[model samples]
Target: MIVLLNLGFTITSTSQAADKIAIVDISSIFQQLPQRETVAKKLEDEFKKRATELQSMERDLKIKMQQLQLNGSNMEPDARISLEKSLIAQRDNLSTKAHAFEQDNRRRQTEERDKILNCIQEAVRIVATKKNYDIVINANAIAYANNAKDITNDVLKQVK
Candidate 1:
């Protein structure tokens, strides 16, 4: 009975040892995937539009402030003070709005990039399962690995 028990344990260990180990280069997959460029271009175009709008608003604000300054200097004290305050307030408000828009745009891009990475993760998991990988690692995590062991192409195919 002891010999049979030892034999069974050896067989189980051998089977487990036979399982495949693979490595994936996630950065490579992201770089190679078409979705990466599509998402990046969309983000760029959105930011470009916002920047153009901000530039136009800035030009308008400068013009309005210059006109206010010229007219305020010749006006009554209260009127001049009010105009000065309004110009300052408008400048501050626009600055704040532009800053907020930039922050929100960056956050949106980060969230989208993360979502794409999640999809890539899922694709890797599915392909690894189909290929019977017992252990999968990022290529960057290993110092020395053959190019053959890098499953970047496989992951990209699955993701795309």
Candidate 2:
């Protein structure tokens, strides 16, 4: 009987020492971050010139295509062939530039997103350490948690 009582006490103490867990809504925090908007604006500004140039090229190509359709039948065979080759080359150039622009934009967005996520992670770590939390879990991974255990706001404050 005494041995069983001692075992029960040990179990109780172990349960009492359970780790302090906290939850954070990473997506919510990410959305609310000012850095996200700033990065978006920066990327927009960086790519705006390229986007405008692509639009201009597209417009020019459309105009040339229209002109060819209207006048190709009346033009000399060699001149028509030359104009067709030129349009094809222009289209290929525009396609290449547009593809490169898209790749660059995506790369920059990924880089900025990684930086922002790292910032959020650091903030979560700081909040968790300062608040004596033993574990910090992403809110999305869990089905349910009490509001009191949510440290998302604290993390956001730390980040900002």
Candidate 3:
């Protein structure tokens, strides 16, 4: 019984000595960063022209489609066939452009997100080092963390 008591004491002391835990909400940090807004603005400005052009093309495609549908029954066979072919070609072009725009937008967003993530990591590292944190975990993975142990605000301040 004495040996078992000693073992329990040792385990408890070891755990106490090793408990230097902190939690941060990385998503909250990311969203709270001013850099996120800058990146979003840059992406919007970069893609604005292409997005506008795509919109214009879509409008044109819609108008042409309506015209075809409305006039198809009254038009001569050859004329109707020609107009249909033109509409098909325009639709294909619009589809291709729209797909390319979407891909480019996604890539740019991913790049910006990565850059912000790197910044957040650096901020966390700085805060952790300064506060002498032995282990910092994302709060998202924890069911509950004491507000005292949550360093998200500290990390955000450092990041900002």
Candidate 4:
């Protein structure tokens, strides 16, 4: 009975060892993807116009402020009050627009990042499936793994 039990244990261990496992560095894969740069450039281009407009508004505000400081004493009281109110309104408008711009840019960046991540995941799945991997793990989640089991390059190739 002891001999049979030992034989069964050996079989179980052997079968467990036979499982095909692979590790992938997802961050490395993401950084190496050529599409990453393309996406960044696209985002930059998309936001460039808004950024330029904001800068122009800022310059105009600064000039107005300087003019007020330089000529406030010479201006009629009513005219000075009116200029002050206009500056305040312009400043508030610029602030609101700038805040919205930042939020929109962040949202777009996150959207783009998620899309790239999805692409990477699909590539990993394809490589794992084609190579008959029973388990695939992210390198970041583990303490250490043999370099031989790393299938990052294969996934990168698939993604590219």
The C-alpha lDDT values of all candidates are 0.83, 0.92, 0.89, 0.93
Write model 4 residue lDDT over 57-140, tens digit each, in one string: 999999999999999999999999999999999999999999999999999999999999999999999999998887899999
Taking all chains together, the TM-score of candidate 4 against the true structure is 0.85
Tens-digit lDDT track for model 2 on 1-160? 9999999999987655444788899999999989899999999999999999999999999999999999999999999999999999999999999999999999999999999999999999999999898889999998876553889999999989
Model 1's number of clashes is: 0
lDDT by residue for model 1 (4-54), tens? 999999999866754567788998887887888899888888788778888
| Among all candidates shown, the one with the greatest TM-score | 3
Off by over 4 Å in 1: 1-19, 44-51, 65-80, 146-148
- Give one clash count per candidate, in the order shown: 0, 0, 0, 0
Candidate number with the higher lDDT (1 or 2): 2
lDDT pick, better of 2 and 4: 4
Per-residue error for 126 in candidate 1, Å, reads 1.6
Top lDDT hit:
4
Q: Which residue pairs come into collision in candidate 3?
A: none
Off by over 4 Å in 2: 1-19, 146-148
